[model samples]
Structures are given as C-alpha cells and as structure tokens.
Target: MKDHTGKPVYFDEEFREISLMLLKAKTRWQIDQLKQYADEAIIFIDEPILSALGSSSYLGVSETETARLLKELIDVIKNEGGISGIHCCGNADWPMAIKCGPDIINFDAYDYAGTLALYPEEFRGFLEKGGYLAWGIVPTSEAIAGENPESIRKRFEQGVEKLSLHIPKDLILSNIMLTPSCGTGTRTVEETIKVFQLLMRLKEEYA
Candidate 1:
C-alpha cells in the first residue's frame, strides 16, 4: 500500500510480527495501569484505522481478522475486570464493530451519529446486552469555533431521537456517554481548553 505521500508501505511478515508485539506490549501496559490506578478501568482501543478498513487502499485487509484482533483485546480487558471500548473516528462497518463484543462503542457522533443509527437492530442488541455508547458530540476541529454546549446538546438529542425509533429511548439514554469527536492533540491549546470546557458544561447539564 501507499501512504498519503504515495510512499510504498508494506504489511509484510516482519511488519505483522512487529505490529502484534506492539499490540501485546500496549495491552500489558494498559492492564498494569488498570491494576495500579483504579478498581475498574475504562480502556478505549482507539482504532481510527477502522475508518479506512473498507476503503480501496485497505481492500486486502480481512474484516474477520480485524474483528478477531479487536475481540482478542476486548476479551483480555474484560477478563482483567476492565471496561473495554472501541473508538472509530469515522464511519465503518458498525455491525462488525458491534460483533467484536466491546463493552462500549465510541464514534464521532458530531458528524457520523447517523452512520451508527443505520444499524438499529445491531445497536439495540448491543445495548440490550449492557453495552454503552460513547457519543463523541464535541467537535475537535475548527468546527468547534461555531459550536456551544446548547448546540451540541441539541445535536445529541437529535441523534438519540433517531436511534429511539427502533431502540427504547430509555435504554439508549441510560447507557450513553459523551466525548470529543476525536483526540484534540492536533488542536491549539486554546481550542483544546474550549473543547473540555464545552464538554464539562454539557456533562453538568446532563448530570
């Protein structure tokens, strides 16, 4: 495959081995953090890569393998007494993600909430099995400049309203969380601060 700069990248055997090693190391570190800090940890496996899974560039990637990898980590997290979540910053195969058996599903609700809503039956089953949905309603980009808590809240309610058509409103509401659309790492400090402030204000109202 070629990267954004069109540089050739290979997912050869050596690369696959290194990737697995890295994943294992990361998982161990997360488990240690869980053990050291809190009785229960909410660990999110942020896989922005899933957003590109079905794209032409990743057509060779197997969906089954992807699901297996996610489920393997999720199983370990749960077995170690942690809540596991998967965050995909863009639209992907929502049903596939759900089938991975994560305790939570986090998505860019600010832009792609409807994408998940399209899988009503799958989402309903997930929720019924005590899965949570982390709604990433706060924008992490310049778009944040045009948003406030009220607008964000309104958008969230609208998303819920759409999902409530097939799933019980109470079920959806009871198992929901809020988050930024993605990490704010690339944003300016001022923008990052605003993002948290908006998130806190929304949390206060909802709480």
Candidate 2:
C-alpha cells in the first residue's frame, strides 16, 4: 500500500495483485447484479483498486490497463442496458474517464469549473453525444459547509454559462445533472441533509 506522499508504507505485491483481481471480479459482479434490478437506470463501477490514494487526487491505470479495464466494464454496462458513470471528486484524468466509455462523467465542476470550460472542443463533443455531465455543485468541504442553495445554484449557473458557450443550451440542459462536490461521509449530518436539499432545489429551479 502507498500513501498520498507516494511512499510505500506497506509492501505486499502478491496481496495487492490478488486484491486487484478481487476488485475487478466484484465490479463485474455488481455490473451483472445491477442489471438484474429493474429499477436501476445507472451502474457506477467504483474502480478504486489502483486509487488507494485519495479520491480527488490524480490517479488512474496506465494507458494499456485503462483501455483494457474500461473496455471490459463498458461492455458489461452496455450489455446490461444501463448508463455507466464514474465519480471522482478529487482531481483526476478527465480524458481517461471519457475514454472509459461511461455515459456520464461525474466530476466536481463547482470547484474546477474553469478547467473543464477551457476544453470546449472536447466538452462539446462529449455533450453532442447522449453523454451526461453530472456536476457536483454542492459544497461539502468543511471549510465551506455553510453554503446554501442559492450560493450553490449560482455556482452551477455560472458553470452552465461557460459550458453553454461551447455547447447548445438544450443539449446542456438535457444532459446536466447536479450533485455534491463529494460524498457526505466526511461531513456533519446537518451539512449532509442540507446538501441533498440544496441539490433538489437547484434541480427543480433549473430544470
């Protein structure tokens, strides 16, 4: 195992390999199981096997490995008739996620809105397809947990303006979905509740 500092805190290559295999198996299993559930519309395969690092931190498989794993996972989702997505709140390789064949890319647009907007060509191309862009607009970080719906809504609206300049309004509206900057596991209960409520309000008002 390794920490964010990129230092090896633990050394067990054999166990690590086994763990990866188990994760791949479990992901495949969940993809299969999720397909069996009629109410399910999406299946997000969590690929944290290599991301033993933090969630937002930049980390992913090598090119060859990424292609292989993504192809297999995407195939599973396609066969199951479910929309696939990947949620990486922390910084990540957006291009790699796009190449993973996910129908949607869940990212923290609220924080790095400018970075994505800069790639108009690629962003437009992704939107031109039936792909969705799930924006994590709600602020969940402890430093800014006091955010309200109005504040979050404005943040998203600004992002929309940036994205709309490159992609058509109808296209952006049809495909955009709102979410929190990250999970609430690290937040207080009140903040977590506010996050969902704020998200709902934003969706309702905007949609």
Candidate 3:
C-alpha cells in the first residue's frame, strides 16, 4: 500500500503505477545524494516485496514476478558497488530472497533460529551462494533493552550451536552478522543509544 522506505511519502492507490525497480532506483539516487554529507557506511535498500507478496493487496502478483523485480534491483545496486541488505522481520520468502541476490538476509534469528537451522538444504545453498545471515539477536524494546551483553552473547552462541548442525563454526562466523531484533524507532532514544553502546562493547570483546 505505502512505500516502506522510511520516507515522508504518503502514496495514494494511484501510486501503484510505479514498479519496484523504479522505486529502488529513486531511493538509490537519494542515498547517493546523502552520501556527500554522511560518514562512509554500507548501504542497504529495503524493498519489502516479500512482505508485500504475502499481503492480500499483492495477491494478484506471482512469486516469480516479485523475485524478478528484486533481482533487477539487486543487480543495479551490485553494479554500483554497494553492499545490499533486505530486511524481512516477519515471515519471508527466504528461498526467493536468496535467489534475488541480497548480500545480507536480515531476519529474526533470536526467535526463529531453528527454522533456518533445520532447513539444511536451503541454508547450505544460501551459504554456498555467498549470502550472509544478519541475525537479529539484540532486543530493541525498552523492556528487553536492559539485557546484558553476556546474555545476548550467550543467546548468539546458542544460535550458533543450532546452526552448526548445517554449517561449521568457522563458516558460520565468517557469514554471521549480529543485529538488533528490530529497529529501535519504537523505543526511546535512550534505549537506542544503549543498544549501540552494548554492540560496541561486544565488538571490543569479540574482535
């Protein structure tokens, strides 16, 4: 229905005229413009097509169509030498996402760690094809934000243990990324800062 790119755009039903690739192109242009004033950092574009695919509004489109759109957008970003990530916090079309060419797959690993782990064939295929798993382990809510790094680290380790059934420890570490369970936009600014500081401390200890 609406563009999920965190912009101020309020789209009407008429806005469905735009294709997803065009949306990615416009967003990429905006990112390029912002790069001049921001610090150097990896850029990720959230298309949310998979989430859309599962919605009633998008029921008219086939999975293949959505995947094709995602593939085209990912190719454009890859050609521009940009790191690309797709965030699908809810249930997603993972097999489709893997083939669509996202370098990073951001998912709720803290809760659904076993879902991916048990799917050995799919998980192995994704790993072999060079897709990294951005595990959403750190909680972002005010209530869960008070968790200590040790507890978070242990949760991550446990996830590793489960994932080890399909992948080796070294291989998992190479492709693993730790992230907040979700965006902190719903939380207070203080909680967001705390998440950053906690992550920094983990980096120092792990690095």
lDDT over C-alpha atoms for residue 13 of model 1: 51
Question: Model 2 clash pairs?
Answer: 56-90, 56-91
Which parts of model 1 have CA positions greater than 4 angstroms off?
1-10, 13-18
TM-score, ranked from best to worst: 1, 3, 2
- Tens-place lDDT digits, model 3, residues 1-207: 446775322233244336564677775786677668764324565554565676887666678766776777777666665667777765677777877878888877666676676466776777777778888877776646558878878877898888887887777777877787678899778888887776666667666
Candidate 2 at residue 154, lDDT?
82
Could you tell me every candidate's TM-score relative to the true structure? Answer: 0.90, 0.77, 0.79
List lDDT for all candidates, in order: 0.86, 0.70, 0.71
Q: How close is candidate 2 to the true structure, as a TM-score?
A: 0.77
What's the residue-level lDDT of 114 in candidate 3? 68
Better of 2 and 3 by TM-score: 3
What is the C-alpha local distance difference test score of candidate 1?
A: 0.86
Q: Note the clash tally of each candidate.
A: 0, 2, 0
Best by TM-score: 1
What is the lDDT, from 0 to 100, of the residue 25 in candidate 1?
A: 74
RMSD (Cα, Å) for all candidates, in order, is 2.8, 4.7, 4.6
